[model samples]
Target: MSTSSNSIARMWRTVLPRRGSVARASDRFQAGLLIFVALLALAALPVSAAIGSETYVRQQGESAQQVSERSQVAATLLADGPDITVNSRAGVVGNSRLTDAAWLLPDGTRRVGKVVAGQGRLKGETLTVWVDRTGSPVDPPLRGAGVVIDAVVLGLGLWLGALALLALGYRLAVFSLDRFRFAQWQHEWFHQLDRKTRS
Candidate 1:
């Protein structure tokens, strides 16, 4: 059987028992808790998926709109910008500092702003800068991989977090049941010993 089928079978075995099987109060409660957790997780799956999909759709739509409303233009550096800082903490690279720059708008108007540039870029150097409908230099819009990545990350993170909470709850339930069972066993043992002594 496939792994998913195997998992489903195992879960059913846990939540279901043989016909006419007897159980103590603690055992029944534990079983009920297990079933509750399973059902809760299953119920949350759709909610999480919907949230992820909604976020992706919204982001993709916004990204497309931004792309349509924005354009990249070459801007001339007006001043020497601060050196770009390259720091890699977890496989992510980022550039820091924006240089004073000016670019011509599509309507033949000049726009001035601080635009991102590489390290050691000197005055009179030209760099590509994104501009919005207003012809103001603006940050680039997110697209493609970024939108999908964010959606996946959010979905997985929420799902995994919920699973972790459920696992912890199940462990606590089992611990409580085990303790109750042990106490019951001890009580029966003591009762049997007392009866034997009296006899």
Candidate 2:
């Protein structure tokens, strides 16, 4: 038989309580507990997915609201951006650098503010900036991709945490069972020795 089939057969023999089975009661209990934990893990899949779906829906709505409240505008840099070497030496990995810039508000008024620009950009260069209705620079709106990623991370993290707990419980159960089996063996050994000495 195949290795997988042999393993399945062995598991079944260990879990099934049958007459004349050489397996001890503790062994059968451990096997049964393992099967139960596997089934519980499978059952948690749908629950985790549901939680993820709910989180995605709620965050997607929030993202949509943010997009509506935010607008992107072209900002003219007023000063030279940080040098590329300085940015790299400062452990800044991305192209972003804080620099003074100016952009037009919705009311046609010009607003000067510190905006994030690419490193090595010279004065008068234009870059896209996200701003609120007051023409104040703000972080970019959350994207759909970010919402999905958050949901996936939360769902997977919860599932993994649950698996860790289940594994811990299994380990504890096995430890207790091992202790019980050892004690039983010691008692049987002494009983056999006593009977031999009496006879």
Candidate 3:
């Protein structure tokens, strides 16, 4: 038989009590616990999905707000950016640097500030920059792809963490059960020895 079919048959034998089967009470309990863990893992799926959906919605709202508040403008570099450095072991380094630049605000007023520019860029080179209402440089607005990725990562992480906890609990329970079964066997062996000596 296939491995999966063999596993299923073994599970059935352990989970279901038979009239003349050698399965012990502990064995049945362990099987029940295993089934319960599997059920809990299945139940966690919908819960994680719900949480991820909520996260996606909330993040999309925030991203929309950011897009509304931010503006992109062309800025001209006023000075040379830091030169790109090469390392013997790291190859090319310093891909970005803070450089003086100027851009026109919404009101047609010019604003001068230090903005992050590509390394080795010379003066007068133009680059797109994101700014807020006050013309202060800011990070670009969050994208839809980022929101989806965040939600998926959070959901997957939560599900995996739940599975880890369940597996740990099952292992601890099995360890305790094995210890109890060993002690019971030891006690039975000594009791039979005592009875034989007394008789």
**Clash totals, every prediction:** 0, 0, 0
1-199: candidate 3 lDDT, tens digit per residue? 9998997688788999678888889988998898899999999989998999999999999999999999999999999988888999999886887899999998999999999998889999999999999999999999999999999999988999999999999999999999999999999999999999999
Candidates' TM-scores? 0.76, 0.83, 0.86
Query: Which candidate ranks first by TM-score, i.e. highest?
Result: 3
What tens digits encode model 1's per-residue C-alpha lDDT throughout 1-199?
8998896665565456567756565666776788899889988788888888999999999999999999999999999866656577654345547779999988899988888877778899999989999988888988879999999888888888898999998998899889889999999999999999999
Assess candidate 3 and give its TM-score to the true structure: 0.86
- Off-target runs (Cα >4 Å) in candidate 3 are 190-199
Output the TM-score of candidate 2: 0.83
Task: Enumerate residue pairs that collide in model 3.
Answer: none
lDDT of 2 by residue, 55-147 (tens): 999999999998999999999999999776545467755466789999998779999999987778999999999999788999999999999
**Distance from true position, residue 16, model 2, in Å?**
2.6
RMSD of each: 4.1, 3.0, 2.3
Worst 10 residues of 2 by lDDT: 85-94
